[model samples]
Target: MSLLVDTANRDTLHTLLLKLTADTKPLWGKMTPQQMIEHLIENVQYTNGTLIPICRRSPEEALEAKQRGLNPDVQIPKNLFLGDLPAEYAYLNLPASVTRLMADLELFDRYFKTNAMAIHGGFGPMDYNEWIIWHSKHFTHHFRQFGLIEGDI
Candidate 1:
């Protein structure tokens, strides 16, 4: 996968974020504009010192999943298998989806610029390249879900 920690990837993410909005309904699944913003924030928060309880996978399951990949698989339960939404985020009063998305994009850009390669858990630290690869894959997944084509501007 092309690394996303570089200038090009950052620009692409920024552009893609601009392309998303509250009115932009997904082709599948359900999430309001605010919900989507919060969802994306959680992706970075996992590495930004937030404490998410391990799903208590068996040693084998964990290892197998790791071998397949980390961030992508790690995020499955959050998106595909959600728990209760936090009270704080469950109620987002975004005046407009476009405005909210722009704010979220800024927040993501700021966080990523500073600590995109941070490593949490016991896996140790990752380099920018690894971070970008993981992040780009994630962004792409959500972007596609919203019916935004891969190369569409």
Candidate 2:
């Protein structure tokens, strides 16, 4: 089986995303499947240098957050909103949005390949491996929101 828990694994992401459809409704949030995919794409923007990240947490806070954020087993609480809210989905349609997400994922991988680290608004600076762990946890969170995965990742 694919390493389904590894968000950095392209095949794993692709396999999971194949379960998503426009009609999918989040079990705990207002986001539709398209919105969720777009949100993830926007997240990639921060690491790929498409969007500049503004660090919102103090250094100590960021340190603590990074500890938690990088733990793949840690589950982000349901219905919790981060301080930085993502903009509305572009609604480019499901297929279009998936295409963009795949492209953005490529950029995300490429960026990390060349750069050692990137700044996260809440968790501060993270190396490529740290970022991969963050993405794994994050995608697991969103997948649970849409009921795409069950139990622990």
What TM-scores do the predictions have? 0.57, 0.88
| Model 2 agreement with the true structure over 1-153: per-residue lDDT tens digits | 122358677887887888998888888877778878888888888988788898899999999989987765566888886554446558568888888888887888888878888899889998888877777778878888898888743
Per-residue C-alpha lDDT of model 1 across residues 47-79, encoded as one tens digit per residue: 444434243565666555544554543332224
Clashing pairs in 1: none
Whole-model lDDT per candidate? 0.52, 0.80
Considering every candidate listed, which one attains the maximal TM-score? 2
Best by lDDT: 2
lDDT of 2 at 136: 76
In model 2, what lDDT does residue 89 have?
A: 58
How close is each model in CA RMSD to the real structure? 5.8, 2.9
